[model samples]
Target: MASYASKQLLSIAIIFFCALGHLTSAQIVTLEVKEGNSTCIKAELVARFSVAYNTTNGTRTVTFPFPGNATVGNRSSCGGTELPPLLAASFGDGHALILRFSINGSQYRVESLALEYNLNDSSIFPNSSSPSLVTVKTDSAGILAQINTTYRCESSWPVSLGGGSGNASGNASVTFSNMRLQAYMLGSDLSRNETVCTADQSVTTVAPKTSPVTPAPVPTVPGNPERGNYNVTNNNGTICLMAYMGLQLNLTYPSSVQNKTVQEVVNLQPNQTKSSGSCEVSNATLQLRDDRTNLTFSFTLNTTSNKYHLSGISITATWPDMKEPFSASNGSLDYLRGTLGRSYLCSAEQTLVVDQTFAINTFHLQVQPFGVNGGQFEAAEECQLDEDNMLIPIIVGAALAGLVLIVLIAYLIGRKRSHAGYQTI
Candidate 1:
């Protein structure tokens, strides 16, 4: 009888040990971050975590938060669940959780696989201000075409379900990758939490449409011809294209895409150099023309010292139809036309650092080869100096002569009337 009783007690002890081992191992848990949405440039982060139980009695309290100092809440459907008056977070709350997490070395690393991210927090989260998106394409091998950073209007925090251990000896761990971030508006009524759970369900779609770029229109006068292809080059290997008339255009290197070229007919705006701002083309000057006569043309070039230099060049040619006033019309205006060539010559007097920038000092460039169309000349004939220019001086001389004749006629008439009266007496 004693031996039989001892066997029964030993059997019971072995069962108890097995049950304890199963209980300790049964509460395995894992957490995952499901990305939330938001719109603010610097956004708060919200994530969802799921806790699963391998055994029954799987109840556990969860304290999840949006990554930043954000408030937390639950969906309307989850009424009376863990999120009414959700967690109010402060910057330094000892228990306040933040979004930045890492998972290389922590206690419970092995049991993290059974858990997943919960999808319930969509209602509270705001859209992402800058959401990262990935695009994959297939070539010979699968390739990633592009990765875009997008902005979303809303996002939420992660929800954790089914796992935790109150014992300090038990381990807890997580891995943060293939992850996303979202934000939520803090502080909503507690009643809404329960309603949010069952309210609605739909597949989340990427946001559609972006603001389109509109190029400003430039009004043009019908009859007046204007200059096009305006360009400027400084010695610093930089060439800026000047917006002609009331327009602004952007300059860029060859290797860019999208808004790479900003050509708009915007109202002319002045970029005045400030006293403290470093100057580029110190004495920048401009020449204007209406692309017609290449001979005697109007040109203005100014230097950094506020001094102006000008030249009016022309070449003359004789045509069969030329006679009197018509002959002078054949004279062509001489002007400089080649690109300022992406080269700038600094003022010989000053020293410049290798890559440092300085202002434009001198602007006047002389048009060499002054005479006939021999080298840079557009016409073959000698510059007509006399005939076509005669009209202005001749007109002035004729006016003066006519004025003298009028005065003399009046004096003679007076004298003749006086002599006639005397002779009659």
Candidate 2:
């Protein structure tokens, strides 16, 4: 009878250990639903349920159906309570689940189970490569209170959420519904934990316009005319004249007469013949003309003191059409006395005249020939001469003429008287 009692106690202990293992074992609950092609949603719950029995009573079996269209698989064990098979389901929005269980002749019921799901993955998260978190919450009567979770993979695996506009190559979405999850009672509520995964995508491109540039205007400048005049005296006393327009100049001998020197002291009758060397030319004039400009000069000869043998020449010029001032300069004077050619000489003393003329719009002188010395000449309206010293030669000539006339009359009267005294012998 003692061996029989020992065997009964050992069998009871074995049954209690089996029931404890069933209550402590874990089960998996999966849910899958769809929203559209652009999003993906999934959820899972790992849970264990337990039932308590009175110590005096023997073991009891409890069977329950999972809520909604959930199905069961993969049974497990726990401590002092038995865990039912795993439950899972899939449906559209707004689905419900109810869990019913009978433990030790007492019934426990949880009703009106609904899941509130949210996916926060959009174009707002620009730099995030990972999918957004999925949140699932149950009403007060459900076994799981709330779950913030993620899934391993999503249909829209890689997505670019950025600022621009273009179409995505492939678009897909995921969802979750009617997932039966089990949990133990803590105070007055039942709860489970889970994670769901999702993703987002976008593309954008743009083309910009360009602008044109404008060019700056070119500037205009007025042209300047070339102008200058020069005079040269050779060894034979002939004068050379040169005048310029633009870069061109007419180089010619204006005077071919050799200059004569005046004697320092001379007494002669009014009509007396004097050698050319004893008299010099004076009161000379030069006139130069062109279509746009005119130049004139009056000169005198001084054989004794003038180095150029010509002096007292004053220059004047006028430009009828030009509003600007005309300028000229005598740039050089080279006296090549012994090197002069024969054509530069003159045969006799005579008056020098020059009437060089042209017609042109622009004139500028670049070079002046050598063998002459003078000041620069500029275009002007009038030039005055010193005529006060010109009367000395005139007065001297009158006095000499009067003296010769008186002498001639006295000689004639004396000759007549002498003849009368001879009495026609």
Q: Deviation in angstroms for 39 in model 2?
A: 14
Model 2 C-alpha lDDT per residue in residues 1-425, reported as the tens digit of each score: 33444454456556655654554333345543322331122334442111111122432212121233443212211113454222224222322222322222111222222221111222222232222332222111212111221212111111101111112111111122223332322222222222111110001121111111101111121233223333433446555332232212211111223222110101111122111111124333334444433333333332332212122122222333223334332211111011111112211111111111111112222212222234232222110011112333555566557556555665565566656666854
- Expressed as tens digits, the lDDT of each residue in 81-166 for candidate 1 is 34221122222222222222111221001111222122222222123121121111111100000012112212111111112222
lDDT of 1: 0.23
Alpha-carbon lDDT, every model: 0.23, 0.25
Return model 1's CA RMSD, one decimal: 43.0
RMSD vs true structure, all candidates: 43.0, 64.8
Off by over 4 Å in 1: 1-41, 45-59, 63-93, 100-425
